[model samples]
Target: MIHRSISEYFSPYTLQKVEVDGKEGYVLIDREGYYKGPDEGIDIALKLLLAYGDAGIQKALDDENKSIHLENMGFDFQKTGRYVRHGKPVYKRGEFDLFKRVWSFHCGFCGKKVSIDVQPEYWYIVDQHGIRKSNTLSDRACSEICAKHIWDEYLELWLKNNRYSTELGK
Candidate 1:
């Protein structure tokens, strides 16, 4: 049998109301269980908290119900050549389109130009090979926020579809 700490077994991210100096704000507990400074700002922190909360709830439901496999509906990771100091290979979702021509797409969440080579906007990856794959959604976004929004929308749609299928016994 294996052993795991509560923090390790549970989520690595936590939101806490904290005070620094004379100001009060929220701080995030990072993966290492260390208090990350409040430099992430309140809005982003709240958004991250909501996203993580949704993820945790979904995880629990998935574990207990087992009717829906959300992991199989998520991203498809590919091994990259890069490795960390711990000898673990870095994984990425989509290969960079480095075929010489300029490829661009509008962000699925925010209407912004995303290109292979651009400032303030770059490539984002969506699961290309999955039941949740969408042609209407762009494969790229301008920022992490937009990317998360796109993913959330996709997941919502996928869950709805799956629920309908299971209910209808299809």
Candidate 2:
């Protein structure tokens, strides 16, 4: 049961207990059709104190929590940090507008939030069908090292898949 003030702080939203990583956690759901967590409900409430007037934190939490669902669906999320939409990567290089909206991306390698102001580099492989072949998330890399790491993972997946297909054909 969450406290009343906490509920109002995230007004119009309510908490629902849900299992995460085999443990009990709470997710925030709202009438407006927004979903926020599968985390310790109290933890999110406490974070509000540190949010420092950043309304975007709620959206960020929603984005991060999405990984839980992705993993539950058997996505090799850790190996390839990618998500696709309409057979294309959800995020693209050189696509950002800080003035228009908060641009927050989880680093492909480290899982840290990429700096909002920095233009992030995207690494992915598109197959002939225009489907992205990598399982990694299509978010930005925080640095050259992270970018290299993402590329290496994608290249490895591509090579492994190609090897399997070649073997099966013979």
Candidate 3:
């Protein structure tokens, strides 16, 4: 059993209301920069930040600072790395650390060991559907071969259930 508080996981930051482009929204302030999102309340914003994870939130802040620096230097667009989608800056997604944390596990298909020796690309994390815990996966594959085999089996079931109505009538 792990005991932890919400505050324990979050980095020190301040939340406040701010106006951007004549529209009101909330911003979270930290040492690096502020995170601006929709006009959602403070609680929702906090939840969003928490879901993004500490490292992700820091990345967003750093990206924002970099953007500001470039704009100040008269660059119309960022030099590299940052992505803009539909006129808003899109931050990079953080690397999922679950694989590293649960390093010692048997392949869900063949019961093979998944380790650093087994190149990272070969392994797959299969998120189980309809499970009680979101933190865990229903199955994992130690190699690409196992993953494809498992997916092929799953696809058969999916096709059976999702067949066209006309095809079923025939």
Top-TM-score structure, candidate number:
1
| Model 3 ranges off by over 4 Å | 1-102, 117-121, 125-138, 164-170
**Model 3: per-residue lDDT, tens digit, 15-53?**
767799999965666646656345434676678777676
The reply for model 2, stretches above 4 Å from the true place, is 1-96, 117-131, 134-137, 164-170
Candidate 1 residue lDDT tens string, 1-63:
223477656765677777889798666787777876656556566875875677466665555
TM-score of each: 0.37, 0.31, 0.29
| lDDT assessment of candidate 3 | 0.48
Ranked by TM-score from best down, the candidates are 1, 2, 3
Better of 1 and 3 by TM-score: 1
The ten-residue window of minimal lDDT in model 3 covers 161-170
Minimum summed lDDT over a 10-residue window in model 1 is located at: 76-85
- Looking at model 3, the pairs that clash are none
> What is candidate 2's local distance difference test score?
0.51
Q: Which candidate, 1 or 2, would have the higher TM-score against the true structure?
A: 1
The per-model lDDT (C-alpha) reads: 0.52, 0.51, 0.48
Instruction: Please write out the lDDT profile of model 2 over residues 1-170, one tens digit for every residue.
Output: 12236556556767777898999976788777678654645566777676745767776666555544444433443454444323344333544555676656677788876554655343323321322333544435666566655655554454355332212111
lDDT over C-alpha atoms for residue 33 of model 3: 65
Error of 1 at 121 (Å): 5.4
